[model samples]
Target: MEATISLTSQDVTKQDPTALFSPKNPIPMETIFLSNIDQAVVFPVETVFFFQVPPTKASSTLNICEVVKRAVAEVLLVPYYFMAGRLNFNHGSNRLELVCNNAGVMFVGATSRLALKDLGNLSLPNASFHRFIHRPGLYKSLDETPLFTIQVTRFKCGGFALGFMTNHAILDGKSASEMFHNLASICRGEGLKTHVFPNERTSLRARNPPQIKFPHNEYVKIPKIPSLATSFTTQNQTSPSPLIFSNKYDHKLFHFTPSMLKSLKDKAITKTSSFEAIVAHLWRARTKVVFGNTDELSTVLFAVDIRKKISPPLLAGFVGNGVVTAFATAKVRDLVERPFCFCVEKVREGGERVTSEYVRSVVDWLEVYKGIPSTCNGNNFYVSAWWKLPFNELDLGFGRLVHGGPIVSGNDEFVLLLEGNGGGINVWLGLEREKMKRFMNHVFDI
Candidate 1:
């Protein structure tokens, strides 16, 4: 009733010689620069999930490892066209490394019931997956292998969870999800006839000869002694403020019923736009219960994908960082004293100001102050909601996931949102252990 699947380079090589490289293509100079920048950031870390069915008359008929092997083979056959063309750190002298060449798939063997517990204890190999922003020049390859790792364990209830790790520079959340979906579909005898092609066209291209408007110098202010902490505290202290939430971290996906959605919209209408209003309301609710203070200062930040919002839509399938906007707002007193709806309104206004021009301004600001130490306001609370977007539609064909949630990138100051099947929202909140407990009690009680 138990099994393990392991795949290696030899198995992959035997299937296809063209697994990682393309002979006829050359990447452009600009793409190399973009890859370098992406390597500098740390948010887009890669991971994957597999939902296992219990061994039954029907389930036992299929060989899961064979399915995964086929999936890996398929991914290898195609060149990570983008990575293969770009050089690491924009060094023209260095050659681009194929994405598949840099990455490999590992199979961890464990029982289904203990899967989650096992994954919870698993840390990404320090040797393979290091935080990009924390350590510069550590990873050498342009499409450097991401020290990919995989773990398979059975759930207590006779199911399983497949966990994976990869570097953020190679893929964004959306892209990684797509790859896993395709792999799953192909593994299930679906076959890989239709390539789940990455969008590389105009919807993601950079501004031709990208211009710097405000310049990095204008917005980036470096502090004399940089403090790694980026969250606010009730008092000035060296350590970041602890997040207030219960210790039990459970992932739940729920849909907003028509009435609930309508009520939320009506509440938001009085104060901010739809997105901000909802985020603000959630922030206030969670903070109130966890912090035990209506007046604790906090901020909510979200992403604004600029592919369509830019002057001219970016090139389609461009596959680099194209998100340009983040929104934030906070109030210790206003949150405690003001009506919840009012607070929601303020958050809405703050988010709306992050237009294409604003995004350009921020980038320009970064360009000007490239190496300067900047003081970032860590005291504000952070919230990101990307559920309404196409994240859940990442159907790799074994039937859309019943639930899919985002993993926290070691950021203890924020809450993120994702889409859930059956029309609900999945909220991921990371706070101080003590605070998390209180917040969970409040939410579950409600």
Candidate 2:
């Protein structure tokens, strides 16, 4: 039997006057633009995750829509103040505009205990909610409308997971996590006990922005399509057409033991590097497994947060986009032709080049090139290690999350670092279908 849940459009507008923005609490305009830039980089692509909630008495009493609305309201209140006072950039303050829409929900009936393992293979409905986000659009305007999509799907186990697709420009992964926790809390009839308060003192101060020391001359470059130029010329050219990369693939997590880490580290002495060096070595090993003798170039890119790297640390709890740099390494030869240690060393050197000065330079360049059409380096792969970062400790109340995965919608070349509960590293890789299969076989020696 299939289970069903539904929601009717309702004007659920709740605002805190204290959270309202005014000239008295004006934020720098540059900050707003930077926040949008941060969102553009991280978002542009959508992120989705599958959750398995075992049937419980709590699941039965859940009113999915009400829970979501209340949670969004609470979360918005916190960020509203943060954006009003704390969000800053080289240009000005970053203010957030909230536009909440009623995205329809769904219901899936089941006859027996649902096997979540199978849900992993199940595809949800293909509606405007999924399609509209896949396309690109102008996202820099502070007044651009915010969108939230919520869908409730019943499982074979008589439980449900609320699937949400939110624009990252509006909130980061951590902020969204907090919002979800609050939503869950409100669903359980728990009063808003701990309200979100902006850490104004630490969060609003402006540190010296990043300055590029050694600008990359060989950044991945994409030539402008003449068609795009014509489209913009003929139409309203204020917003550039959005670019979407096709990303459909399978992924799994791999754990490396401490002993294994030690082995890799010890091996690195011959190469003269640290843990990241050894990990890069392993990454090459995996790459070789997939590519065989290919001569095509492959790249590894990782994020470098600029919050603390600046002269003075950025204000704490600023709650907007703060990322400043991305470290990358690339090679063209077949993985088998290179020594694993050599590849590791190259990656290490590249990562070290991303310094506070380099970050500042990037910010400066962005400031100068705000409206100019820029090209992105089309690389074979991208990897981000959030495991060592504070992503795991994003506690909004339901205890620390055991696992967190990025809900990326349109890029195939990506990797995420996750912290396991038992003190291990979880590496989630998303690759193009054919390449991913080959890569998996190489990793497992299957």
lDDT of 1 by residue, 1-446 (tens): 11222222221111111222333234332243332223223322433343534345224413443444445645533433443332233234231222322223334434332423333312111111121111112233323333344443334434444445544445555555555555555656675534545434333223445565533311224333244443321111212222222234332223344355557767554633456655766666665654545455555555556656666666554455555435444566676567767767666666566567765555544433322212134334455565653444434333223333434444444556555335555555555566665666654321
Q: Model 2, 36: alpha-carbon shift in Å?
A: 7.7
Cα RMSD for candidates in order? 9.1, 8.8
Candidate 1 differs from the real structure by a C-alpha RMSD in angstroms, to one decimal, of 9.1
Query: Model 1 segments beyond 4 Å from truth?
Result: 1-31, 35-40, 44-48, 52-62, 75-160, 188-261, 270-274, 285-298, 370-378, 389-400, 408-411, 418-422, 433-446
lDDT for every model?
0.42, 0.41
Error of 1 at 88 (Å): 4.7
Best by lDDT: 1
Off by over 4 Å in 2: 1-31, 35-60, 78-147, 150-158, 178-212, 217-262, 270-279, 282-298, 333-338, 369-378, 386-404, 408-410, 418-426, 430-446
lDDT score at residue 33, model 1, on the 0-100 scale: 36
Task: Give a tens-digit lDDT track for model 2, residues 1-446.
Answer: 12222211221111211112322222333223333234234232233333444445325424543444445444433433323222112222322222222211111111213434443322221122231121223444323322344443333543443445444444555545555555555545675434753333223222356343566432322233243221111111222234332335455555655555556666556644334753475467556644544665555555555557765676555444555435444554644466555666766776677666665555445433331212233333445555554433333232222233444333344555555445555565555577666776555321
Whole-model alpha-carbon lDDT for candidate 2: 0.41
